[model samples]
Target: MATEYLSEKHLRGFDKYKYNAKDTSPLSIYVMHPFWNSVVKIFPDWFAPNLMTFLGFLILVLSFILLSLADWSYYASSRTYPQHPPVSNLVFLIIGVGLFVAHTLDGIDGKQARRTNSSSPLGELFDHGSDSVISCLLPIGVYSIFGRDEKDYGANILLLYLIVCVISATFYISHWEKYLTGVMFLPWAYDFSQLALVVIYIITSIFGYEIWKGTYAFGFEFRYLFVLTTMGGSVVLSLPNTIWNIYVSYRDGTGKNRSFFHAVEPAIPAVLLFVVASLWAFLSPTDILQLEPRIFCLTVGIIMSNICCHLIISQMTETRAKCFNWLLVPLMIVATLSVSTNLGSLELYLLYCLAAVALILHFHYACSVVVQLADHFNIYVFSLEKRSPKAARVSNGTK
Candidate 1:
C-alpha cells in the first residue's frame, strides 16, 4: 500500500517488527497489571484495544475542557486572586474519576490486545503515541488543582513550566533509551504518579483547594515537593538506570551500537522544544504564559507528541529516527516573533495562532500515520477486523 509520513524503509522494517520491553516497577507489576488484567475482562472481546486507548485520551480531553471552562486563566483556586472563583468541587471530583478510569483503560489496552490476539505495531503506535500527548495533559490537569498563583502556594509560570518540561522530557527519555538500546524500559514513576494525582484530586475534592495553601515545616511550599520528588526520582533512579542500561548495551555489544553522535541524535527535537518553549515563555513581550497558560501548555504537548510519534514509528518499525521535526520550524518562528517584536496584546493572539497551527500539524500527522499503518497492515485502526485488499487496476484502470 502507498504511505505518507512513513518511507519505504519503514514499511520494509515492519515485516520484522516485534515489541520487546520490560516493566519492572513494583506498582505496575504487582498491582496495576493485575488490576488491569481484571479490568480488561470486563470488556467484551469485540471491543478493540485502540478504542480503549482513544477513550482514555478522550476522557483526559474532557478533564482539560472542564478545567478550562472554570479556570481559563488558571486563577481559579489562587489565594492571590480574590475575585477569581474556586473551581467547582464537582469538577475536581469528575476529573478524579476521569483520571482514574483513563489510567485504568490505559493500563489494560495491551492486555486486551493480547487477550483477543489483536496485537500489532499499530497498538504500540496508538498506545504510546497517545501517551506522549497524555504525558502533557496529565500535568496541565493537575496544575488546575494548585494553579499558577506564585504569590501563594500555587506555582509560578516558570516553575510550572519546569514541572511540565520534566514530565515530558522523562517520558521522551524512556523512548529515546529504547531507540538506542532496542528495548523499552518502562518508567516506575508512571503508575505511582497517576495514583498520587488521584489521591491529590480526591483530597482537593474533599478538603477544598485551600488545604494546600500553606508552607511546609522546612519553609518550602508543599507544591515544590512535587517538583522535587519528580526530579529526584528521575535523577537518582531513572536517569542513572537509563544511562547504565545504555552503557551496558554498548559495552556488551548488544544494542544498535552506533557512535556517540548518532546515539544522542534523536534528542535534538526535544532539546529545541525545551529551548524555544523556555525562551517564548520567559521572554514573551506580553508574558504569554500568564495571559494563557493552557494554550501554551497544550501547544507544547501537541508538538512534543508529534516528535514522539515520529520516534515511536521509528522505534516500532526499527527505522532511523528523525534528527529534526518540521513541527519545530513553526514553533521556532513563533518563539522568535514573540521575543523579537513588541507585539503587546497581539502576542496572545499569536500564541493562539501558534496553538492552532500545532494542533493542525499534529492532527494531520496522527491521521496520516495511522491510516498509512492500517493500510499497510490490511487491518483497521479501532477495530480487530482486517480490511479486504484494495482491488488492483491494470493498464486499463480495471479492477
Candidate 2:
C-alpha cells in the first residue's frame, strides 16, 4: 500500500525530516501532562495509536449524529407551530460526555505512541487530521444545542459563520507557523480551549438550552456572550502570538521572504470558506437559520475540514500553499442560480450533495498525502515495528 503511495526516491528524501514538539502551556505542563502520563502508564502495551485516533474520531461522529437528530427534532416540532420542542437534558449530557471522551482519547493517543515506542510523523499527521475534523464539528455541536429562532436568523447565521472562520483561522495559523519554523508550538489557549468547550457542553447540559438564550449582563444573551468571549478571546490571544512568532523567525533568519502574504496565505482558505458560506446564505430562497440548520453547519464543517486537510498536505509534501479552489464551484453554482432562477428545495438539496462530495474528495486527498508520507517513512498506519539493528544503532549514535 505504501509503495503505491510513494516511490523509493521520495522515501529517502523524507528520511531527513525531523519533528519538534514545543508546548509551553502551563495547563499542559502542570495538569494535562500529569493526567495523561498517568493514563499512559496504565495503557496496555498492545494498544495501537492509530486505533485510538480512530476511536476518538468515531466518538465525535456519534456525538455529531446525536446532536443533529436532536436539532432536527427541534426544527420539525417548531415547524408545526412556533415554539421549539423541549430537548431532553440527557441528550446534552450524553453529547457532552462523548465530546469529553473524544478529547481525552485524542490526547492519549500520542502518549500511547511514545510509551509504546511507536512515535512517527504519520501518527502526528493522523492526530492533527482528526483534530481538524473535530474543530469544525465542535462549533456545529454548540450551535445545534442552542436551537435557532426565526427572529434571530441574521444574527445567528452571522455569529455561526464568524465562529467557524475564527476556528479555521486559528488552526491554519498554527500549522503555518510550523511550516515556517519547523517547531510546533502549543499555546496556553490550545491547552485550555478544549476543556473550555467541554465545560460549555456540560453547562448546556445542566442548564438546558433555554438558559443560554436568556439575557445575561450587558443586555446580551448568555450564548452570544459565550461565543463572543470564546471566539474573540481566542483571536485576541492567538493572533498576536502568531505575529510575534513570524517576526522572530524573520529576525533570526529562520523564515525567508518576510511578506504579508506569507503570514496571511494560510488563512485564505478560511476566509474563502466564510465568503462562500455568506454568499450561500445571501442567495438562498430560505433563510439559513430556517433551512435545515444542522446541514448548513455540517457543510461549513466539511469545508473547514477540507481547508485544514489542504494545509496539512501542502506542508507534508513541501508544496506551495494554496486554498482549495474546488470549494468555490458550489458557491458559484448557487450564485448563478440565485441570479438566473430561485433555488427550490430540490436544487438546494442538490447543492448540498455537491458540497458533500467535494468534502469527500478533500478528505481523500488528505489521506493520500498521509499514506505517501507513511510509505516514505516505512511506517504502517496502525502498527509500529522495531527498526533494524543497524538503523537502531544509527539512531542512538545521532542521539
TM-score of every prediction relative to native: 0.94, 0.84
Compared with the true structure, model 2 gives a TM-score of 0.84
Candidate models: Cα lDDT each: 0.84, 0.67
Cα RMSDs, all models:
2.8, 5.0
User: Candidate 1, clashing residue pairs?
Assistant: none
lDDT of 2 by residue, 249-352 (tens): 87887753436766567767677777767776666675643465556666766767777766665565455567455775675666557545666676557666
> What number of clashing residue pairs does each candidate have, in the order they appear?
0, 0
Model 2, residue 279: distance off in Å is: 2.2
Q: With candidate 1 superimposed using the best TM-score fit, by how many Å does residue 190's alpha carbon deviate from the native?
A: 0.7
Off by over 4 Å in 2: 1-13, 73-84, 150-155, 217-220, 256-268, 385-399
Badly placed stretches (over 4 Å) of model 1 are: 1-3, 217-220, 390-399
What lDDT is reached at residue 378 by model 2? 52
True-structure lDDT of candidate 1: 0.84
